[model samples]
Target: MELLNLPGNIIETVVRMLVNQRKTEEIKIRRLNFVQCLEDVLNLRATCVRLLEIVNNTRLKFPCVVNFSWKDPELNFDLHCFINFMANDTNWRFETVRFRKTLFHVEETNSGLLSIMQKNASLFAKSVARLNFDLPLGSNSIVLNVLNLLDWLRRESLKAGGQISFCIKDPFFSNWEAVLLVDHLSIRGSLRRQFDIFIHLVGSQKFPNLSQLDLPDIIFPVAKLCLFRNLHALSICNLELPENEHIPLHSTQITALLLSYAELESDEVECFSNVLCQCFPRLVYLSFKNTYRTTFSDDDNLCLPETCTTVETYSHMLFYFKKCQSIRYFNLQDYYPALDRKIFVKQLLTTLGTRTALMSVRFCGKELTRTDFMSAVENIVEECHSLDVLSVDCCLLDTQDSLNDQTEIDLSKIVRGEKILPIDGQESEAMLKLKDLCRDKQLKLLIMGKTVLYKSTADVRLMGEINKLEDLYKWNLKRGCVQWLSLEN
Candidate 1:
């Protein structure tokens, strides 16, 4: 009460504390399926508060996100003086400035988007270190406007020593581009023109610090991957790599690479792996998501979907992973095994068993059953003594069952020398089984689904924390393994 009654200046400090506390509480509540908007992650402070504090007090300078608006209000001070102050305020920089237009299905044009960017690009150039351009899926493609905006952004944002992350999302879909937007490709050259602009933005020397690119399904059939100078991380989704690949020389500074929903063949796995190694020589983290397609065939007058992973292709995948020695963290999602359980077990161990340098491996899939997955991992633990961290995420694939089944093994007795863990009312039977089996092994268990204890022993602990999503998936910095950052961004 006293703090609220104090002067507004004193109240601002309290507001920051309140914001931090709220974040902690939010994380605690949403333990699993932590849904969030990663892009334009507006800093805790509001734009007005941030700019006011920084302009008045330089120590408070922090990155601020501002949405572009044509009819912008004038501040109390002179615009020229404010910009000049920012020029001298070298330490102060913004995280990103977002430029968004209309939503999907709305009859809006890029004119407003361009209008705001044209007017405000230079005003906050010094403080804007990054740009998050969120655009809607419009029927008409404004290639020239977008190109001009990118060109202007290249000139302005480069001065601020920053880059841009572009995202094109629609109202209806989570990420189904071909199903909806592909029809807008009637004008053949428009798509190519957009690609040209994007490629130019990546390869251009004008924006030397241009880094962190996200070209999701909106820009598929990309002709080539350009060399991103000074780029530390890159993300791409829904791209169909050309059969005839053209990989750039490993002249990049990128450390993290993510490819989602990329259609790749087993025969091409070796070539693609080499291409990745060549393009990002210093890469330490790599992730591939939803790459396995559930192919459906007409079987007995029914279109049945295939459940297993492509054997020859995945076998090649294992072979290719060997070349990526630099990858410390690797994530494979929706890669259901196509081979028989026996052969799949052999392949899993042969590919992942000997890798001594890999610090983390996260497997999230929908198609693999609990039994096959557990057995394969058990072999992995048997073969590899050095590997420590293994995580599984099966949110998309399976149905939950009750824990009342009496045949359920009591793993805690064997692994931890403790009694069986008591199941909460809502606890999934699958996860409980995994914890029961995997607790005793030397390897640290961080699983998202039910799988084998993987070692000779089992584990079980009746702890409330273990059942929560936050506990199973610890978001620690040193042991951080986030594969869905690009999806949210």
Candidate 2:
């Protein structure tokens, strides 16, 4: 009521401030708080007649697309308020809508809820609608509701010239016709016995516009890869290749490939690499990681050799990139074979140097002394001429006191934890030296360790790469070169 007594300009400013508090540009609203949002707006409008006039005239934008979850089906009926509000406000533009999670346990009495949701879906037919289902295969009425909703959303999305994307598990694979409509599809669980049928469908032109794929566990043959002619990016966690004399050539549209825990026989390494190179000729980004043991028990340690306990060097793993000359970004992690640090580094540098176009490289699972690690950095800088970014995931052990002061210390000869001393100022200075070297060569270095993490200061762009996009992939690190580093000019 105090606002009514204020000057006209002041009252108008207050109203504008309150409305602008919720910005109209690209707002995201979760499902649970939909009612509260409307209540808050209506409360403000009900405060006074002048406020009601201003609120009615001013466009209060809601989320373009409405999202509903099965967690609270009853609340879905309340969604009509928001939709009705959007309907009245012709100035509000509806964009895309996405519905996710399993749909279960809708009583027969609440069957009108599906109709209400379907009517809403029909309004947004010219926009994208993504539906992700993780449901059990059963004759439940709820599943029928979900399928019916998906049918409307998918049909509307297509009519709008937008594609529907799905993240479905094994059970939903039965709906092959619906699956074919997906532009971006991620198969969560194993395909199991249906893998062959899935492969056959893929080769038979089932997924015509499929662009992005994430296959968690499967025995996807190298020959069938060509079936995904429109794929742009692919993530495969576990893959087993069948013995095939002939390999199919894949379309060169795929640009990103991520592989984790894909075990390969030593003989099959080169063949696989050759097939991969032959298949995806345009692939510029690659990530390969194995399940290297992070922690070990004393009982298990007794059975393993000291060399085996350290980082295992799959020197032959270099064959993968050797086959692909177009790769610009490569990430290798946790593949182990018992080999000395120096030998592995030498093999890595030699193999990587041949990939003249490679711009960024990240590797984990190898342990190195500080001296050896610095030496490897120097070698990579000198040999890999085209490389602009390098990231090392392993912690380096300093053999001696790495302090800057050149004073005599008896602790140098003291043995602690296999004669490897904890990193000190010396390692930081060494990193600074490498940083300077990389800076001179126009390179960026990202070394993962407590010392580096705390000592090194990252620039705005580098920090964004480390913080924002790290979680997007299974591997946590920047994929390509950083434009800038926080280095003293």
Candidate 3:
């Protein structure tokens, strides 16, 4: 056989093809490290060109996740440019580009971004599966950019026969930023027309495929409640209902719900109860932080019957507790007034009674004395048999001083089936009654104080008694505040 001599260009082309074929196969077999490979490719101009061509030709698909690293600016820029190029290339049929980074930097803008996206709208509309946008913590025209990007995507999703998933990152706010986020995203009033157009383009049909959503600190009711029929996990903050306004009770396919700064007024509570009872039959995890400003009023027509009277308000939350039978973890925070706290604890136990599925419970409050705190623990041990992790914090009183004096008062008698006589002061009477109830029930108790001043010898003594009768844990109130307890076992 005669050896055939090949041209230099042809030999070079064949070698390049062999190398890319090996890399592509490695990617397919999961043998190539994506980060290392991308880094190496980015470092070489030749490799970068080859990788870009390979990416364009093969159109690889990847999962989208939120990224928030200031160190990977070059990678972010590269990815953004690549996405824009693919979106603008009418000849390319790339579908399903995973967007990383939930927080978008407003300072990073290219005029070519929109025009390219608009030019390739048809192709993008046909292929994109998940779109993740990051809204960084800056006051720039990021919202407008998001609106423009969304508009283009919406138009494309309409022409295409596939669903799209959208996610946004929200930062904490003290003033109107939260409100602005809501107003910008919510499809209400005359803006409803524009929203309806958007809904038709991307909402009604595409939203059913949404599986995970995260809105860490923004509250937009209209946007939140609209397209979550198939949502599995959601994180939100500052969820509140307006006075005299009624939120319709609707169920979504949500399994985990995390809410912060939730303001559930009397009426909204009822509406929520009705919806939760009937709609979220499969919900398993629910967490909420009730804002400090929430209050109960007798004239509030939407207030549940249990909340109609001052006595009832104490246990009113119980009325809605039974509805969430599938819940495994429950967290409540910043709930106030000693009476409300006591009622809430009692009702929670009664509502969750003997439910073996519960794994954790956390409650934070202010102004709770040692007596009231111990009673709450006993109630939980007696009533909620499934609790594995329990936390309770008193916000107003000193824990150390209170615990020390409290221990000297004889708690083992109370915990070991012995009743204590009531004292004359109103506060003392409440404390004595709680102790008596715990003694009668023979329950384990855990107490925590929120200030170092609260972590005195008295607290240590009280904690000792609690350990004697059952199990007891005490946290120094002053050192770390609320986060220390959260971090502990």
- The models' CA-based lDDT, in order, is 0.39, 0.49, 0.40
Give the TM-scores of the predictions, in the order they appear. Answer: 0.44, 0.54, 0.37
Model 1: residues with Cα > 4 Å off, grouped in runs: 1-131, 137-164, 168-193, 197-206, 217-227, 236-250, 261-274, 288-316, 322-327, 337-347, 356-377, 397-441, 445-489
lDDT of 2 by residue, 1-489 (tens): 676787766655664444333322113222324333345456777887777666655544333323334325474545565577655643332344455444444652145535655556534645443444444443445445555656765665434456556666544554465466677787766576667777777878888988888786754566667677788878787445546646444545776666655565555555665555566666544555553433222222111111111111233344433433444444443233243334335555665565542232222222434565456567776667665445553422232322122222211121111234345326556656765666655454443321122124345665544433242333334322213335443
Candidate 2 overall Cα lDDT vs. reference? 0.49
Q: Regarding lDDT, does 2 or 3 come out ahead?
A: 2
lDDT of 3 by residue, 232-318 (tens): 656566444433335554556665555655566564666555544444445544554443434455433322122111111112334
| TM-score, cand. 2 | 0.54
For model 1, residues 116-154, the per-residue Cα lDDT tens digits are 445545444554555555555534343334455556666
**TM-score ranking from best to worst?**
2, 1, 3
Candidate 3 stretches greater than 4 Å from native: 1-133, 137-201, 204-209, 214-229, 234-252, 257-274, 277-281, 288-316, 322-328, 337-341, 344-351, 356-372, 391-489
For lDDT, the strongest prediction is 2
